[model samples]
Target: MKMLAATLSILLATSAAAAPGDADFAKGLLKKGVAFDTVKGRGKVPAYAAYLKTVLVDGGFAASDIAIEPVGETANLHLVWKGSGKKPPIAVAGHMDVVEADPKDWIRDPFTAVEEGGYVFGRGAGDNKFDVSMVIATLVALKAEGFKPGRDIHLFLSGDEETEGVTADLQAKQAKAAGVELLLNSDGGGGGLDDAGKPVGYSLSAAEKTYADYTLTVVDPGGHSSRPTATNAIAALAAATARVAAYRFPAQINEITRASLVAAAKETPGQLGDAMRAFVANPQDATAIAMLRTDPGSVGQIGTTCVPTMVSGGHAPNALPQKAALTVNCRIFPGVTVASVRGDLERAVADPAVKVAIGQEWVSTPASPLRPDVVAAVTKAVAAAHPGITPTPAMDAGASDSVYYRALGIPSYGVSGLFMKESDAFAHGLNERIPVSAIAPALVHWRALLTELAR
Candidate 1:
């Protein structure tokens, strides 16, 4: 008995001493993730796929553990790590493709994977690579330690998330076919600590709005500019754009937003929490909504957003355009379908002369089904991870591939055990990064969440 107790004590001490090394491994993974981003793989899906392969290999992913399934123009890779059967498998998902960046705007080469002043600078650093590296390093360390998960773990890596969400959608479909119990995608924003350094509750995305694009076309009889009709196509488009911008849909208080507001109120002091509560109680209150709208992070909760992204319709300076078109992208709320948004547009424009047609761009699923299992599991797990931090069930304003699964009636949740200052973390911007301190603890949180859900 003494020998056994002595051996256990030594093992525990060794584990404690070795824990700090995990941070170093995390740094190594960050280096690899930044290196992966160095290749100009945006929109080059094949290159993105190649990059993922290199990352998986370099990150110590077993060959048999990761498999790439190609769908038309997307690649969905399923990474499986066998477990000890104590729990089922949970999926950790993220996209490898980053939005395009201009080299001139960056302080360093956006693709160079530069590590200076504690930041591993790169294009996809915050947008996703950070989470990806964190997961890889955690799992690799666990595997090396002979730590089999209580449940099977799957790491789903999708290419072309920046271009479209088809890859993740397809991958979710495949997982559903295999009876995947819990699907967790690390895409939605994480919990941010407030000014007082208190951790704000994490956001477990139960839903996300649908994304739709529509092109407004204006046509007139061709003629010289000098003899043009009173209404120019561009002029008409400008008017249409103005009307769309002016159009305001009624404010809504959905389950997710309500929860988000209440939780936020608790984390904040004085006016911030009061403001959040006021907004939650009556989103229709003009003053409350206006106040919340001032914060870009909270604006999406008030309602959906429509932005005019592209416009084209002109020939020569002297010749009046025969046709003109403007494309407007709308992020439709979950309860409202594309059809309803179209109907709303029809009413907003109230002009038979203007033709509004939905574009043929890739279709995305609505937010994942807000199933009871996922909500309960995530809420419990988050609470366990950050005591006193009340997580809010929320709908992601931006679309994630989980929307694809939700559309198919498969419940998917976006939960990452990491958070940072929105201003400092550059995702889809220059100098994207995650704090090195955030990595090790996040591993513990993720492992716990996965274990809980799998069981």
Candidate 2:
């Protein structure tokens, strides 16, 4: 999910090793959250925020310390757990809304959280609700235990991350005014297991590519289908989109991608792995670039990527198209301006008659400088799930609400507690889920991160 006025949005999983009672509580929270159907246009996010508020207030949080403010049809939930010492707040962030999933396309009702064969299946189960539930439950349990941190801890939940990011933009300014020192986003960054259940290094997303959507349009005078015309809007639109599809922005790299690529190279096998290493050593390696481009997983990490996602044309089949349009979404490399990406798209279209304009936009932020304390906290947390697993720094291809906070100068880290196999991830897709066994360890992970960092 990205469309920063230039690049922009998006987020999963768990297992056991800690308290089963608390794990069950988290699962309950998740099931209840899933039942709400907080998808955009549903107008249900406020109700969901109300439910979450109850979870906090019932678990010992004061009602005054929490607020549910409406943003459009959705709402944001902010909570504070005050600590004894004087320091800028340490925040934990995530989104309340999830992408739309049709009931007909899923085996189970996409909104119903179903626990099946050690997995919980639902739309937001893996993408975000899993981690969001864990964070909420952990804070509740910590409060009950009377564990006080060294500074105030805050929770910032955005109403719409899968579509527009307005909630996050507003929240970041509030966080800055409140003097937030750093943020731990539960939406991205986590450990992964191989097919054999062995650890594949944990990732701490330090940066993300910019996301934007551009609209390309062609317009012409309508005429009967029997009357052939050379300046047909539909034909011109098709050609323009085809050119955009064939276009490729130059390959690029930055601190986080460089580290992530090298780390990935060590784990990946064969020619792809070699290409990763070569590209890192020399970004201009054409052979390495070609090889990397062949794999979708490796491709976005190396450079900017754009694809035509949506299209529409004539009103009726019998009439020649009066207008035709396409929406091209792009994930731009860091340090690149939104205006620059728009310029590239305009050049690719290369048709002066074809209108090019912004369809959607969002903000972009640089890679957060690695902080030793954050690294240590995340490492210890990851170890709770997989002993000796050291998390590596990464730049996520998809943007998150964390980008908004980063734009404001607060260092934010994606330190999701869930450690899952890549094959198991299904955030914005059908029948999304996360393993049940991953829960207790995540509870442990959050507890470790909160206690260590807040202190």
Candidate 3:
């Protein structure tokens, strides 16, 4: 029990390394994907989908099996690889869209992939594109090698995952109607390498936090700035935001978090490790709670977190603002309702003048149960690809396309193939990139999964 569960398993499992395919081709696909600028409102996702379709078709997939549906300026791609099995289709979840990136803030053009040192630098090089390219390449290779499956395999690529999830929402409905067995999301959950270039371990996300946004609004009669009243809207809004900021959601524990924390304790050092063990043994330990609260990485694991992300007021420089609003975004823990979090925010402000409103319709979902088939297959595939790395099950804090699928009562797991060091991750930051060397084993990973699960 001194080492983490998966960490201990990782050390016990050693095997021959997995064989790779044309990694150079996969790298080329990733670079070409980076050039598309698939951010929202760009009207480029359909074009990107077409390029992928060409690759798949040329590699042996039938062209008629792929459909590109335009949703507003963006699009969704759905592909079906038919089989003879009686079981429902297995789905692979991915997104073509990238978060908005400003080229001025980066050392290289965010849309242009540049290979420097041993990495590829671009806006989406690491986040979803890296594994996305690998998945596509693996499928193509399977088709070319005349590999067939017992059950139909579906690949769904959403167009607006970084902004609105309209595409994923639509895909989830269609997948449910068609009776999709489960989804393997490439958006989150993967392995981490320590600074020494040694594999620490891998994590497969069986659960995730819910994403919701709330607005705190205050309105007042406009007047001259020099004659501002005590009820200035901006001042009242700021105070309300401050209260919500200072308030902390009660510490909570679940099956996934408890296991994840137990694993983290073994790798963590000093007082943090001590606190992790203490909190695991007793969730009500005040000293452990206080110590864990001091760490941002550990704090969110213990509770729902709400923070003011945007605030605006004052229309004119010479006049008092007539209205002001604070936009607070929350990553609600699983099993917590959105309305309950809204209630908490309103109570924290405790001001009649300030109004808290849910900005959109969002649903909180329960964690997906750990299916034995999924866990065993992932463990086997990872051991084959990474040679000694055992994947850990976790509940990630970020929301992904899996959220929609999981909400619809479908089991979804994050099984991204790309693995890298913690420092190499820059999914939404400047100089965003990923190592070029990750392509081969990633190819092996996807191929192995499809071989076992689909076959």
Best by TM-score: 3
Instruction: Residues 94-115, candidate 3: write the lDDT tens digits.
Output: 9999988999898899999999
lDDT of 2 by residue, 3-81 (tens): 5422212110223323323788888998999999999999999999999999899888999999999988999999988
- Candidates ranked by TM-score, best first? 3, 2, 1
If both were scored by lDDT, which would come out higher, candidate 1 or candidate 2?
A: 2
Number of colliding residue pairs in each model: 3, 22, 0
Cα lDDT of model 1 by residue, 1-455, tens digit: 99999999999987765342276666666566665543224335455556555655654667777787765555667788777666555677887667777879888877767777755677777777777766666666565556656677778888767765677777777777765666787877467766554676677877777778988888988699888687788887778888887887777777777776787677677655677888777776787777776677676676777778899998888999888888888877667767767777767777666798888433445445456767666666666656776567777767776766666666677787776765566787766766666666666666566656654
Give model 3's TM-score versus the native structure.
0.88
TM agreement with the true structure for every prediction: 0.80, 0.86, 0.88
| Least accurate 10 contiguous residues by lDDT in model 1 | 36-45
The list of candidate 3 runs beyond 4 A from truth reads: 1-20, 103-105, 220-239, 312-324, 360-363
Task: Estimate the lDDT of model 3.
Answer: 0.88
User: Candidate 3's error at 421, in angstroms?
Assistant: 2.0
TM-score of candidate 1 versus the correct structure, residues matched by position: 0.80
As for candidate 1, its clashing pairs are 87-150, 87-151, 89-152
